[model samples]
Target: MSEGSSSLPLVAIVGPTGSGKSELALQLAERFGGEAVNADSMQFYRGMDIGTAKLPEAERRGIPHHLMDFLGVREDTTVAAFQHMARTAIADIRSRGRLPILVGGSGLYNRAAIDVLEFPGTDPAVRAALEHELELRGLPVLMARLQDVDPVSAERIGDAKRVVRALEVFELTGRPFSSFMPERQYVVPTIQIGLNGDRAELHGRLAARVHGMVDAGLMDEVASLIPEGLREGRTARKALGYEQFLRVLDGESTVARASEETIVATRQFARRQITWFRADPRVQWLDWSQAGLGGAAEALVANSGVAGA
Candidate 1:
């Protein structure tokens, strides 16, 4: 909130899954004397390391990372909560005379951190009625209704819960949920570095990453968390690999099948992420395989018009 308090630009590293965003964030933070603030929604949960591809502490290379591993599996965080927390982290990092480098593929969460967006209030009664309608009329019916009332939101939202929420917002506020979507306006001095590469190469990397997670004991990790009420967790249970692996644990699916499903799901997720970030003209995209990528990013920061780099 203090515009003149810090001299460093708020840096964000964004890209699809398996595009080296995390490593790039670390390199830039180290170069600019910054701390890493997580915008990845899944990485917020504790004990979700393998599936989320969270960097182990040693791999963090002594850079202090914020807003990670802070939530119980069963806890749910709204975008509003994340926005407040992320802004607070950025302000704190700047107060300490350090740059704040945000890193994640969760597009909305990334925007919430640096964009001038405000969430609308929720009404329990309105939400309850929508939920009741969803149960009675089903998702497709509600989704169709949303298409009529707020076609932009309907096109973007797919899941049952979000569809219901969108309808609720429309009913309560007489405004489309898409009206609240973040504009390309920054709340602070910021620079976004987006990583991308050949689509086929990215697919191969993602598949290999999923297989690597399986080999790294993703099943065992899920097994360990089951006793911790992983199944009861609303959002955590739905994570890509965890969801499939949970089926395997229930004897409803085989690990190989789950792995394959996870690969497919992860690839789809990456595509969505790509679409989300690519639409933002403010982002400066760099290839993941660019030579001297770290140095190139540093040069961007240096020329970003921030007081200090």
Candidate 2:
């Protein structure tokens, strides 16, 4: 290690779905003496393995991983809880003298893990009211309302869950939700390497990955979880693959249709993720098609001293 390269830059491998972020994180972890900390929201659950494309134990290459396989499928997961856990895992990894590699495509989870992002205090009454409003007037009503109060946030947050959270923040604090974005300041000096893939190629890869997951017993895994109250899980039930497959189990759709929907949704999600990660200027992107990506990332860290310290 060079002078100041003593501590690795709390490496975060972020990118869209099917961009091979997990593989890169594994390679970098093996080479850089690091342990991977899961930042994918879906992968936090214990039995979501096949659908989440979670790396099997044998595939981890003997590198220790943290913050994965701990949550039950029925439990609701919050970013606040994850932030607490992920930060603690990173600190523990550093104390053990190993690098901490944060990996996943869940943008909020990734940001929550490393950025100086704070979660606003929630009021159950406020949250319930928002939830009720979401059920009645639907997303458009809330979106329009948010546009009135915080157009910047309204433009950036596209989903109902996020919009509701932002609205909850605004109603509770009288502040625009966009104002809370941490200006990309890291709680710890961090190196975020985004995997960039060609759009057409990425789409093809995601489609194939969806097929592979289905072939790997995704339906069966989801079936087993139904008894475990997977449907009641506010967060888990909304997961990409699981959500579609649940429709299949409900007899509302065919497996073929579910698979197709998952592929299309995953592709759309990848585009959104690419856009999100690209907006951050701090990310040092790596072209996945390029040769020696792992070596290049190691060089990026080695060349910069005290990056994560």
For 1-309, candidate 1 gives per-residue lDDT tens digits of 244457667999999999999899888877777799999999999999999999999999999999999998988888889999999999989987788999999888899899999988888899889888887889999999999999998877677767888898899899999999855798888999999999999999999999999999999999999888899887899898999999999999998999999999999989989998998998999998989988888888878864354
What lDDT would candidate 1 get against the real structure? 0.89
Candidate 2 per-residue lDDT over residues 1-309, each given as its tens digit: 233333556889999978788888888777767789999888888898999889999999998889888888788768999999999988888777778889999888899998889888888899899999999999999999999999999877788888989999999999988888867789887888888967888888989999999999999999999888899887787788899999998899999999999999888888889888999999989888888987787777666563332
For each candidate in turn, the TM-score is 0.94, 0.94
What lDDT does each candidate get?
Answer: 0.89, 0.86
Model 2 has an lDDT value of: 0.86
Candidate 1 Cα deviation (angstroms), residue 202: 0.6
Runs of candidate 1 with Cα error greater than 4 angstroms are 1-5, 128-138, 306-309
Query: What's the CA RMSD for each of the models?
Result: 2.3, 2.5
Which ten contiguous residues of candidate 1 have the minimum total lDDT? 1-10
